[model samples]
Target: MSSAGHLYLHTPFCGSRCGYCAFTVEVGVLDRRDAYTDALLAELAVEGERMGTLRTIYVGGGTPSLMGPERIARLLDALRPRCADDVEISMEANPETVDERSLAAYREAGITRVSLGVQSFQAGMLRVLDRQAGPEQAVAAVDAARGAGFESISVDLMFGVPGQTDELLDADLARALEMGVDHISWYELEIKPRTALERAGAALPDEDWAADAYERIVGSLEGAGYRWYETANFARPGHECRHSLGYWSADDYVGLGVGAVSTVNGRRWRNHAGVDAYIGTLSSGVPPTRSVEHLDEPTRRRERWMLALRRDEPMDMRWAGPPDHPEALERLVEGGLIDVDADHIALTRRGRFVQNAILRQLMEYA
Candidate 1:
């Protein structure tokens, strides 16, 4: 079971592209989804040999739910050999693609968790983001997921979106909490180059406003009994995402699909982003990897620190510590940015806000 670890499969088909998305997703390619899935399965069959005892599986997307429930069942069936007896199977779905039947089929096929992408409930914000699903559909998807007997349900919300005000964000968060979901992934809207958001010609808020929004989100979520387990994630007590925690803990995981990234045993690789190339390579029994990385000890430790700090996990000073800025580290500790003791150093609540700055110092000084 320990050897099995984690698996992340990226399903890359979407009905319509969002303004802010930078993912490798196929639009109007639903007709070719099955071919993509076939190639995905072929790759999985090869990878499955090595992950015969998987503990966690995350099916992220373009939109996994768009694959239809029957296809989803087939994907699960292909992975059953690798799945652990007690596994946490998580799938990302959008509101429009979900229904009672699909949710029920997903539950029947061993999907234990559903993460619905409900970017915003505000009508205006949804329009600005180019999201097809309405606020009511978002609520209904959660209800159907819960009714289908999923062990846990998570909702994704976007902050820093154009036309999003604090009141609107508050309303979105309130609706999420009202649904009684177990987990939430709240992320700021990042405008990538060549994205529709950039072409939309709206200036984003400055860093100060973004920080203020983060503070409000943290306050609201923590007040509602949710643990800010990761920089952008919250959950009730035990509902934290197991797959993500694995990465933060420096455990090895495999990513299977077009545009997927896999890191295992200090070696990392990424698959080709183009769908045709991905399918062609796998169909011919060749790996679709476009690049590979070898993470040496120092690199791994640095990566671990960066990942762990975001989760507020304690780091052992013996193996991981600020080696360079002895004076700066002390200054930060004195300034209440971090909490330190003999064995471990952790970010205090105040420190979480300046995590990026601290992380940069830790890496640069070393």
Candidate 2:
């Protein structure tokens, strides 16, 4: 089998957990930074054998920027030799955790792209989300990433937030547009189970209102010359996030660090989610503990269809395999929900708005 070309390194350190976050994260582990980096390197040494020339490397969080440039540089230095010449290296940073000098250092260390976690621009909304960074800090972080000479700078925003009104969302959009960032990941806030938001019974905006907000977000970004390349992602013509595209395109990828998940050669595994366990096992010269699953052909095929439909492009039917309900395709087309060509099928603009519902009628999910 061909080696995987995408890599995702998870850094689980966070100063404090967010109200909406449920990611594998370790808070108050500042002292474990060095050990964590060591663990990641050790894991990479083993996993790297399965990786091909890396096309994309994504350093995601609990706030990867909190690891500081030195740790990141060491990780990249080790990864550089295995990377393609034009590999895209991206890292996610919380605005409160980055600055101009640190961002420059991160750039010098080999990160080509930086995605700032600017969840919202309103102070009340930031508080509701329990974000540490203020509006100005998010702006400064973007400016810093730009000044640091990053090839691309992206920001994350949220809609459907508990207190997010259209005016507030418009303001946030205006701020993002004003900054002229290269990309934006505007996601709806979901009150996931066990999250602080869910526990506190925080309610989201009405579904109809959220739908309108999503439309507005898509329209504003597209109007500003950005492409709605994916469901929740907008970018300038060539600044689309290649790392994320790799995932949507169903490319094999290797993931490193505690709680990181990898799928390669039909086998998927997730490393155990304890930092101590990860570090100790790697230090003992053994692979970290993990839960492994072998994906079946039907599972993979269904996933390919689901992921491909999320993009604003045609899904090659030959590659994706037949849908569970081929008859539904004709019905969907009649309803203007999808466009089907001889060998490919794609969602219409209206269909994209209810992608999940379409997927449900077209396929089965456990």
Please give the lDDT score at residue 71 for candidate 1: 83
Measured by lDDT, the strongest candidate is 2
* Estimated TM-score for each candidate: 0.95, 0.99
Q: Model 2's lDDT to the true fold?
A: 0.94
Per-residue lDDT of model 1, residues 1-366, tens digit only: 334479998999999899888898988878878888888889987776556478999999899999888888888898887678888999999999999888999889888999999988888999988899999999999999988888799999989987777788889878877888999999988889888889878777777888999999999899999999999999999899999898887788999898898887788888878888888888888778679989887787788788888886777867664444556778889888998888788999999999988877667524
Number of clashing residue pairs, candidate 2:
0
For all candidates, what are the clash counts?
0, 0
> How much does each candidate deviate from the true structure in C-alpha RMSD?
1.9, 0.7
Total clashing pairs in model 1 = 0
Q: Which ten residues in a row have the lowest lDDT in candidate 1?
A: 319-328
Most accurate candidate by TM-score:
2
